[model samples]
Target: MSAGLIDVHAHWLPAELFGLPSGSPYGAMRDQDGELFLGDLPLSIRTEAMSDVNAIISDMDAHEISLRALSPPPFAFAVNSSSEDYIDEYNASLSKVVTESTGRLAGLGLTRLDDASAAARQVADIAKAGVLAGVAIPPMLRGASLDVGVLRAVLRSAAQHRLAVLVHPMQLPRPEWSSYYLANLIGNPVETATAVASGILGGVLGELPDLRICFVHGGGCAPAILGRWSHAWQARADVRAGSSIDPRDLFRSAYFDTVTHDLAALELLASHAGEDRILCGTDYPFDMAEPNLPAFVDSTGLDRVALQRSGKAFLGVRVPQTELQ
Candidate 1:
């Protein structure tokens, strides 16, 4: 029983998801001469790698990943009522892939974040499906922060169903970040941090103690700014206006992925968030994905066994000690 790594942050977008019905929000998505385009905006991703399950497994074997959790990319999230049908179709298709993976894959379902009630119902359906381990949501929905709008219902439903939540950033373009690809490089991490702050400061985490949520991109910039947040929370009434829980305390309860792309940063995150709460992750099939995830984890000097356990714990998958050992 060799101890193999579990990746909790890889993505899978089946080719069938691209064939959206006419009324869907992303219905215009089409492959144009080998490039994927959504309404003429070219998406920069490896379509072949994202759509091929056999290739994904071969890559995982090559990279030494034992199991990979699959989630639809953020673009597949339902932003409007018109997207409900498409999102449902997407989740159904994703479940099929999971069923055929023979335990090599787990899936995270997507929901219609634009409508809280609909999203909550979808969360229930996702749990009832039994093949999905969690739900994936964007950190922001339609220009508002996640903590503000329909997310509360979604979070509560996920907690009730014991479904872990993965908060991935949408990477929407901003005027200031228009050039230099800052939308992805800088905006992504900041968006993740904002969601974490919202969860902690907005009383969401305190309200639901059973929620198992993991933030990706090494929890964005949240770990690095804990001290500053603690200081402000202690000194400013406005900072503690709604929630009295300590930022550092609740932040520790949350989970983070190992995608910092820097050893010192990973070490800092471990120091702040505790190594036991860290999980292995590779933003697979993307340009920003860690090229050598296993080697990168080894380079960080963190315990690989602990990370494997954390990933299993996040997905609520329990394995015997003998198997892990």
Candidate 2:
């Protein structure tokens, strides 16, 4: 299948944002600050010159990827600690870069969810910016619940704008997770698990039935543990009292990205979530991503038709057989 694959998950950071050194340790850090601590990878390798739009295009040409959806570097998510003026300037700069890559690439805009109306207005503006296909928001904003008035307001406005939500988790506690290196190994997955758990248990999905949300890292281990959650709910009154709806049903309504990094894991995700709910993802410019991603996905157990249709449907594109494969 040499069809034009559309990667729904990837990240890019322009070099300009990180030239100055500024960011916090526990809170979200900027590219430059992260580079200083995490070493040269953030600055020297993952930025514009290193990521190389031309190189990505060449790689796509060889791999047959027609479209790629770009995300801000994970560090950009931490910009909430900066001034609102800085946030606006940062977003505008990102929008300009992404829009220029319009034909071959699309992007998801980022927003701080603390102010619902301002967030809603940003959503509307990004939609009209003619660059972004969706909005990427942190799973929990400042300590706000998914079903809270603020989040619901933003979601309603997102729904009105017909934007999909790409939910990623901010980094978690460092002390308890530090020893085990669990911040990513365990903490990241747990953060997403808790977010999905909260959304379902709180009945947020039921409220906004039409909203489209895509979960990264194969929904961060939600599929593997959903049954345990269900059993606990049945056995405990307090758990059952959280919401009347079933957690499994909510999982079905959402989507997952194919960044699991193993054939068996991918097969398990498909079994747990169904084929139609899965889409391709590479987590690009990160060392953890597959070296030859398109070929790896091509060889997965997924039905070719399902793989081809998933991205097109997510982007609202009508894929002809020739265009898709």
Best by TM-score: 1
Candidate 2: residue 134 Cα off by (Å):
0.9
lDDT for model 1 comes to 0.83
Q: Candidate 2, residue 237: CA error in Å?
A: 4.1
Clashing pairs in 2: 3-325, 28-78
Q: Local distance difference test, per candidate?
A: 0.83, 0.67
Model 2, 104-178: lDDT tens digits are 776676765557787788778877775567777666656664666556666777777777777776555668887
Q: Identify the candidate with maximal lDDT.
A: 1
- Model 1 alpha-carbon miss at residue 264, Å: 1.0
Off by over 4 Å in 2: 19-46, 49-51, 149-152, 179-181, 317-321
